[model samples]
Target: MTDILIRNIDDDDLRHIDALAAELGISRSELLRRETKDLARRHALQQVTLDDIRRSVDLAQGVLDEDLMKQAWG
Candidate 1:
């Protein structure tokens, strides 16, 4: 992997990051990697199956109940 350096992190931010690393029993670098992976996963979910994402447009127009989506699509 390539190294990416981030400068100008605040003291409080560093402390919080360190605390998270300690909480998860990881090194600070591993903690940062996990954090980035989590952030990417959160955004990536939008691109993955969420039951019925195509229904989102119909949802805005009051066309479906989310609870019923599985039965409808299944």
Candidate 2:
């Protein structure tokens, strides 16, 4: 794998990462890798949810507006 450098990390953030790494019994780099993967996965899931919402909105657009209002008020 290629090496990536992350710069400008705050001291407090670094300390937090270090603490988590110690707690997890892993190196800081390993902890960072795991966290990054988790973040990416969550982001992908959110995108999928947003896409589903968009599709629902688009489908609703074709439905009768009066029906929607009646449903909303009822």
> Number of the top candidate by lDDT?
2
| Model 2 TM | 0.62
Q: Determine which window of 10 residues in candidate 2 has minimal summed lDDT.
A: 44-53
Q: What are the runs in model 1 whose C-alpha is more than 4 Å off?
A: 48-74
| Candidate 1 Cα deviation (angstroms), residue 14 | 0.2
lDDT of 2 by residue, 27-67 (tens): 99999999889998999777657779898999789367887
Which residue pairs show collisions in model 2? none
* Candidate 2 colliding pairs, count: 0
lDDT of 2: 0.88
Candidate 2, residue 55: the lDDT equals 88
Error of 2 at 61 (Å): 16
